[model samples]
Target chain A: MQKEVMFAGFGGQGILLSAKLLAHAAMNQGAEVMWIPSYGPEMRGGTAYCTVIVSDRLIGSPIVKNPTHLVAMNRPSLEKFAPVVKSDGVVMINSSLIPVRSGRDDVDELIVPANDAAIEVGSVRCANIIAVAAFAARSKMVDLEILRECVKSQFASKAKLIPLNMAAFDKGLELAEGK
Target chain B: MAKVLMKGNEAIGEAAIRAGCLNYFAYPITPQSEVAEYLAKRLPEAGGTFVQGESEVAVGYMIFGAAACGERVMTTSSSPGVSLMSEAISYIAGARCPAVFVNIMRGGPGLGGILPSQGDYFQATKGGGHGDYHMLVMAPDGVQEAVEMTMQAFPLAEKYRGPVMIMGDGMIGQMMEPVEFPEDLYVPPTNKDEWATNGMDTRKSDTKNIVKSLYLDPTVLNDHNLLLKSQYDRMKEEEVRFENYNTDGDYQALIVSYGTMSRVCKTAIDEMKAQGLEIGMVRPKTLFPFPEKAIHDAASKPGCKVVVSIEMSMGQMVEDVERVVKGKTPVQWYGQCGGEVPTPQKVMEHIQSLLNS
Candidate 1:
C-alpha cells in the first residue's frame, strides 16, 4: 500500500520535523519513503509544509497533490487542505487552535486538542508530537515502536533532550489512546 | 556497496574524490557551493587539494595549471560563475587538457536567479566558450546517476583529452538521495616528474611542451578545428543516452525534457495516462551528444502529432528538437526560465491542449 501524508503549519510548529520523523519511521519499517519540503523563498514565516510518501513499491512521484492523510497543526492548514483528503482519509486536526471542523463528510476527521494536550504535558510546543501520535494511532502506517526508534535516533546526538522528547511522544500516544 | 543519504552537491564531491580527482578549485555559487565546501573537508582527509580560488576566473586558471601537470582536477559553479569560467574552458579545450567541470545550473541570462533551471542548455551543449570545440556533457536526472556520471567523467575526460561536464540543475544539486560509492574507486597520484614544470633536469626532452591555445597560422587553426570536429563526430556516435517512457503504443503527444524538468514530465505522463491521454516521454540523459536519432524516430511516429519540448529555459533545446524533427512534426516549446520549475499539472495541461487542438 502507498500513502501520502502532508504536515503543514506555521514555520515554528515543527511541521517539517514531524514529516521527517514519519519518513524516518517508514524507512525503518523497510518502506520506500520520500520526504519533500516546500523549498525556496516561501520558507520564511509563511505556512511551511512537507509531503511524505510511504510505499510498498517504488515511489513514482514525490509531489503529492491529494494526500491520504493530513496533520493540520493550525487553522490555515485545515482551511487549505481539508478538501484535498481522499475519501475515508484521516485528517488529524489540532482543535485547540482551530475553532471549526472539516466541511467535507467524505473523509474521517479526528479533532484532538493537540495544543491543550501539550499544555497538560507541560509544553505547548509538543503539539506536533501529539498530532503525530494521533496519525500513527489512526493510520497505523508505522508501528509505535518504529516511531519511538525514529524519535530516539533523531535525538541520539543530544542525549540530554532525549528524555523530554520521549516523554512528549508517550504523552502524545496516551492522548490519542484516550481519544 | 552500502547506501548513504547524500545531497546532490555533496555526492558530486564524493564522486570526484572516488574518481581520483586530487585537485579541486572553485568559487562558491548557489546550488553548487556545497560541492566546494564538502571537498574542502573531505579532500584533505583523502590527501587531495581543495582551493577556494579568488574568483571563478582565477579558479579556472588554477584548474588549467593543475590539469597541465596531468593531475585529475575539477571545478564547479552555477550559471553566472560558469559564464565567467567559459574563457578558461575554451582555453582548456584548445590546449587538450583533461579535467572535469560541473555546472549545478541555476537560472540565467545574467544573474537571473538562484533557483534551479535548465536554461544553460545552449551554453553547455553548443560550447559556452569561444572555440570550435565541444565538452562531453552528461546530464543526470537522479542522485545516483549524478554520482556515477561524475565518477565516469574523470576517465572520460582523460581518454578524450578534453573537458567533461556533469550538467545538473539545483534540484539535483540540493535534493537528498541515497548514493553508493564505487568499491574499487581510488585517486591515483599524478607523476609530477613526467610533464610537470617542477624542474628542468627531470624533463624527458630539452625543448618545452607548450600548452597554449594560440595558433596564429590560419592553416594550423583550421587543422585544430577539424580535429576537434572529428572528436565531436565520434562523440555523437558513442555518447548519446536517453530514456523512453511508454513509447510502445501510438502516442498522441511526444514530450522531450531533461534534467529536473524530465522528472516533472514523468509525473505529468502518469497523470495524463490516468485521464486516458496517450503520451510518451524522451528524456535526454546526455545533452551534448543529444539523442538525435531517438528524437527523429519519435517525431517520425505516425500517430505522434506534436513534439513538445519542455525545459527550464526560454526554449533553448527547442532548436535541437526542431533540427531533429525537421518540420515533419509540429515542434512546440514551453518553459519557465530563471530557476522556476514547471509543474506536472502545467505540463499535462500543455499536452492536453495540444491533443485537443
Candidate 2:
C-alpha cells in the first residue's frame, strides 16, 4: 500500500511533470501521495530529480533515501540511484540513452527504449511520458485509463498536444507490455 | 470540501485566505517563495491583498503595519530572509501586534543551502529577535498539518494580540499532498474595531492611537515585559500539544523531535521497535509552548534510559530537552545539517549507537 519512487533525469526532460501526472492520478484514486522536487540550481540545467511517495496510510518523511521505484532517464541517474533501490524494487531505465544496466541482481529491472519510442510518437519531449507509461504498465500500480485522464487535464490549456502525448504514452505502454 | 493534491507552500497560502487573512507581504526566497507566489494570485480572489516587498526587512514592516491596523496579515521566508526580518519582528513584538509569520527554514547561519533544515530551532523557539519576547511557534510535520496549523494561527494571533509563527522546513514547503480545507476555516472575518487604527472616525474618540515599540520609562517597559511574560506562561499552560507514540509499555529510549524531522524519527522508531529495542517518541506540535511537562513525563518513564534529540541542526532543540530533563535522563543529540536530511537508516544507526553506549 506504500510506494516511494525517485524520478531523475536532465533538467528539461519532464521528470517533475511526469511525477506530477502520477500524483494527480493517484489523488483521483483516493491515495495519499507526496511529490517533493529538488528545488536547487540543478533545475537550471544539470541533473534534476524528484521523490514521489504514494501511500494508503499517512506518508512519513517525504525524503526517501531508498526508494521502491526509480525512473532513471539518463545514465548518471541510473548509475547513482540503481544500487540504492530496496531489494525486490523496480528500476525503469531509459535504455535508449542510458546504454547501461542496473548492476544489482535483486531488483526487477525494466529497460525501456524511451527516447526511441518517443521519436516514433513524433516528439523527443514525450520521452518522459513514454517512460512513465511503460513504468505504469510494468508495475500496474496506477490505472492507465486514469493516467490518460490526468494527462488530458494536465494539458487542457494546450488541447492540441494531447493527442500526440497520448500516442506517446500508448506506444510506451504497448512496448513495455511486450517486454 | 473535496480533497486536492497541493504543494505545501501553496496549501499554506490558501489556508491563510480561508482563515480570512487580509494582507500578505513577503519577499521571494528559495523553498518558501511558493507561498508568496501562491498568495499573489489567490489573495486577490479571496478579497485580500498581496505585496512582494522590496526586501525581507521591508516585508516585515509591511506585515507589522497591516497587523497594527488590526488586519489578519502573514508573511513567509526561509532562514537568511527570516534573519533579515528579525529586527522588525522584535519591534512588532514590543508593539504587541498580532501577525503570522512562517519560516520554511533552510540550513543556515548564512545563506546556506535551500534544503529543509531545523537549524532555526534556536532562532524560532528562543528569541530570534532581541527584547524579552516570544512568538507562538507551531511546527507541522506534513502538508495536511501545515494547512490546519496555518488556519488555527489567525485566531491564536488575535487572541494573544501578539505574533504567531508556523515553522516548517523546506521539505514541508516543497512537498505536495492531498488536503481539504475545513469549511469553517472560511468563516467570516474577525472584528478589528477595538484596537485597530482605522482612522479617528472609526474609533469615535478624541484620542488618536499611536503604534510604537519605544517606551521612554524603564518602569513602563518592565510592566510591558511582565505582561508578555504572563501571556507566554498562559500559552504554556493552555496550548502545549504533543503526540506520544508507542509509549504504552516500558521503552528503552525516548525520542524528542518536531517539524519534519519528527516524522523521520518516527520511521526510525518503527525500525528500532522491530529489532526488539523499544523506542518511544514524543513529537511537539507547538514548539514555543515547549511541551516541557510532556517531555519530562516521557523521559521519566520506567524503562526510558536516554532521551535523544533528533534535529536537522547541529544541536539546538536538544538544549531545551536537556533543560527539561534536568539530568533526570541522559540527553543525547544527533543531527545532519546543511541540506542533508537523516534517513531512517541513519537515524537507527544513531539510536543503536546510543543504546550500545
Candidate 3:
C-alpha cells in the first residue's frame, strides 16, 4: 500500500505537526515513510506545508509532485494545491476558512470546518488536528485509532493538554463521519 | 532495533556519537545546521565535546587538532562551507590524521542557492583540496543509510588513517524517516600511539610522534604521497560499496546514479517497468572508490544497451561513468543544477527520448 499526503496552511497552523502525526502513525504500523517540508526561504512565512509518503515498499523519491491526499487548511493552500491532487484522490478543505471548492469532479472533496470544529470543542490551535482526523477518516490511509494516539502523543510532555486535544480530534472525526 | 522517526541531518549527528566519535566542531549552514544543533546537546550528554567554530575554516583546523590527538573527530557543512574547510582537509590528508566529515551538498559553482544538488560529486571524489588525496566517500540515499554510513565513516577513516566524507545532497540532510541505528556498529577505534601526536608523556620511549605534512625534502614528500596512494589503491580493492536493482533481468537500459538522484531514477524505472520497459539501476554507495568494475559488469549485462548517468549537477559524474563504460555501451548524461532536483517525470521523459533516439 502507498499513499502521499500533503498538509498545507499558515505557518502557525501546525501543518507540520499534523503531517508528522500521520507519518509517525504509519511508521508505528510498520510502513516505510518520509516527511519532507517546503524547506528554504519560502518557509519563513506565508503558506507553510509538508509532504508525508507512506508505503509498504521503499519510497523512491520523497519530494512528491502530486499527492494522493491534500489537506488544505486555508484559501491559498486550496487555490494552489487543489488541482494537483490525483484524479481519484481525497481532499479536505477547511470550510471555516477556505470558502472555495476544489472544482475537480474525479476526486473526493470533504469540506471540513476544522477551525469552527476546533473552537466548538476547545482550542483554536487544534484546527490542524481536526484536519488530520478528517483526512484519516476520508482516505482510510491510516487507522483512526492509531492517528488519535499519534495526536495525543504530540502533547505527551504537557499532561494537562491531552484531554482538550482528544476532544478536538473527536469533534473533527464526528464532522467527517457525518459527511 | 527500535525504530524512531528523525530528520536525516539529526540522525547523522546521533549516528556519529553512537559510532564512538567524541569530538565535533562545526559552523552553521542551511539544510545541514540541524546536524550541528543536534550534536550540541547529544555530544555533551555522551561525554563528548561539541564546538561551534568561529567559522568553517576554524572548525576545519579544530577537527584536525582533535583528530591529531587520536579522537574520532568530525565536522559538517554544505558546499560553500566545505570550500572553506578544504585547505584543512588537505592538511589532514597530508598529515594522515584520521577524521570524519560530512558535506550535505548544495548547488555551487560559487555560493549557489541552498537547495539539493549533487554538483559536488567531482569536488568530493576527485579532491576539493590542493593536493593528491582521496577521501573515502559514502553517498547515502535515505536516513537509515545515512546513519549507517556515518557509523561506518569513522572506522574507514581510522582504517585508512586519512579523511573520510559522507557525501549527500540537501534532501538527504533535510528529509525525515524512520531509522534504526545498528547497535553493533559502534566501534571504538584502535590506539593511535603509532602515528597520532599525543604529548611527550604519551610516548613511552624518546621517539616523538610529530604529525606534520611539511616534508621539505623532495624524496620524503614523494614517499609520503606514494604511501597515501597505496592506501587508496587498497580501498579501491576492498572498500568499494554499491547495490543493484532489477539488474538480473534482461535489461535494455542501465542508469548510474548515487544518493537522491538514484532514488528518483528508481521511481522512473519502476514507472517504466509497468509499461514493459526494462531499465535497471546501479546505486553507488561509495562514490570515491566508485564501483567501477560493477558499472562495467552492469552495463555489460546481456541485453543492456545504453548507460546513463543521472545527477543533480550539470553532468559531472558522467565523466566517471564514461571512463568505466569504455565504449562498451553508449554513455549518456542527464542532469539539472542550481538546487533543482530532476523529478521522476522529468527523468522519465529524458530517458525515453534517449531510448527513442
Candidate 4:
C-alpha cells in the first residue's frame, strides 16, 4: 500500500520541514519514502507546499494527482488541496487559520488548532510540529515513537527548542487521541 | 553504510566524492544549485577543491582544465547554463579529457521555468556542442539511481577518455529519497600519465605530454574524428543500458521513455495491467548508445500494435524511436513541456484511446 501526504501552508510555517521529518521517519522505519517540494519563486507569505509519499513497495511516480491525505496550515492551502484528497483519507485542517470546513462526508476531517497549540506550547513556529503530530497520530501511517525521535533529532542542533517542541508534539497527540 | 534520506542534488555531490572525484567547479542554478552548495561544505572536509566560477561558461573550461590534467572533475548546471558550457564540452571531447557534466534539466529554449523537464533529450543525445561529438548521457529515474549513475560516471568517463553526462529533471534534483552508498563502487582515479600533463619529471620521463584539440592538418583531424568514432562505436556495443517492464507478456502497445518520465509511465502500465490491458515499456537508462536492438525487438513483437515515445518534450525521442523501429509499427509521440509532467492517468487515457482506434 502507498500513502501520499501533502503539507501546504505559508513559507515560514515549516511545511517542507515537517513533511521532510515525516519522510525521514518513514525511511527510518524501512519504508520507501519520497519527499517532493514545490520549488520556485517562493516568498514568506505567498504560498508553499510539499508532498511526502510513503510506501511498502518501490515507489513509481513522484507526482500524485490526488494524495491520500492533506495537512492544510492555511485557508488558501485548505481551499486548494482539500478537494483533491481521496475519499476515506484524512484531511487535517488548521482551524486556527482556516474558518471553513472541507464539506466532504466520506473523508476523515480532524480540526487541529495548531497555531493555538503552538502558542500554548510557547512558540508559534512549532505549529507545524503540532499539525504533523496530529496527522501522524490520527492516520497511524508511522509509529508515533519513531516520529517523536525523528522530531527530537531534527531539533537536536538547536538543543533548547527540544522541550518546547516535544510539549507541542504531546499536546497534538493528546488532542488527536481525544478525537 | 546506513540509508539516509537526501535530496538528489546533494546525493549526487556526495556520490561524486564517494567515487573519489575531489575537484568540483560549478555556478549555481535552480534545482541543481544544491549540488554546488553541498560540495562547498563537504569537499573541503574530504580534502578536495570546490570552486564556484564567475559564470557557467568559465565553469565549463574549469572542468576541461582539471580533466585535461587527469583530475577527476565535474560541474552541475541547468539547461541554459549548460548551453553556455557546450563550447567547452566540445573542446574537452576533442581533447579526449575525462570529465562529468550533470544537467538537472528545467524548461527550455531560453530561461523557460525552474521545473522538471526532459526537454534536453535532443540536446543530450544529439550533441549540444558543435562537431560530431556526443557525451555519454545517462538519465536516472529517481534519487537512488541518480546516486548510482553519478558514482559510475567517473569510471565510465575514464574508460572512454571523454566526457559523461548525468541527465536528470528538476524533480530528480529537488526530491528527497532514501539512498545508500555502497563501498564497492568506489574506483580510484585511473593512471593518466600517458596523456595528462601531470609533468615529465613526476613520471620520470624526458618526454612531455601536450593536450590540445586543435588539429591543423586535415588528415590528422580526420584520424582524430575516426578515433573518437571508434570509441563511440565501442560504447554502442558495450555501454548501452536499459530496463524492461511487462515486456515478457504479449503487450499490445510499447512505451519508450526515460528518466522521471519513465517512472510515471510505469505507474500507468501498472494501472493498465490491473484493468487487463497488457502494455509494456522500454526505459532507456543510457540516452546515448541507446538500446536500439531492444526497442526494435519490442516494437516488432507480434502482438504490439503501436509504439509511443512518451517524454516531457513534445516529440524529441520519438524521432529516435521511429528511426529504430523502422516503420515495423506505427510510432507516436505524447508529452507535456515547460515543467508540467504528464500524469499517469492522462497517459493511460491516451494509450487506451490509441488502442481502441
List interface RMSDs for the candidates, in order: 2.6, 1.1, 0.8, 0.7
User: What digit string (tens of lDDT, one per residue) describes model 3 on residues A25-116?
Assistant: 99999899999987766777687999999999999976688999899999999988988899899899899998789999999998899998
Best by TM-score: 4
DockQ of 1: 0.31
Give model 4's docking category: high
What lDDT score is found at residue A59 in candidate 3?
95
- Any runs in candidate 3 off by more than 4 Å, and if so which? B200-206
The Cα local distance difference test for each model comes to 0.84, 0.88, 0.90, 0.93
Give per-candidate clash totals.
Answer: 1, 0, 0, 0
> Which digits, one per residue and each the tens of the lDDT, describe model 2 over residues A50-166?
988888977766668889989999999999999899998889999899888999999989889999889988999999999888888887778889988998988999999999999
- In model 4, what lDDT does residue B86 have? 96
TM-score of chain A of each: 0.94, 0.96, 0.96, 0.96
lDDT of 1 by residue, B32-135 (tens): 88899999999999999999999999999998989877788999899899899999999999988888999999877798777888888888889899978899
| Model 1 per-residue lDDT at B211 | 72
Of 1 and 2, the candidate ranking higher by TM-score: 2
DockQ by candidate, in order:
0.31, 0.76, 0.78, 0.86
Q: How high is the TM-score of chain B in model 3?
A: 0.98
List fnat per candidate, in order: 0.06, 0.72, 0.64, 0.81
Evaluated at residue B120, the lDDT of candidate 1 is 86
lDDT of 4 by residue, B163-216 (tens): 999999999999999999987888876568778887666775567788899999
Q: Ranking under TM-score, best-scoring first?
A: 4, 3, 2, 1
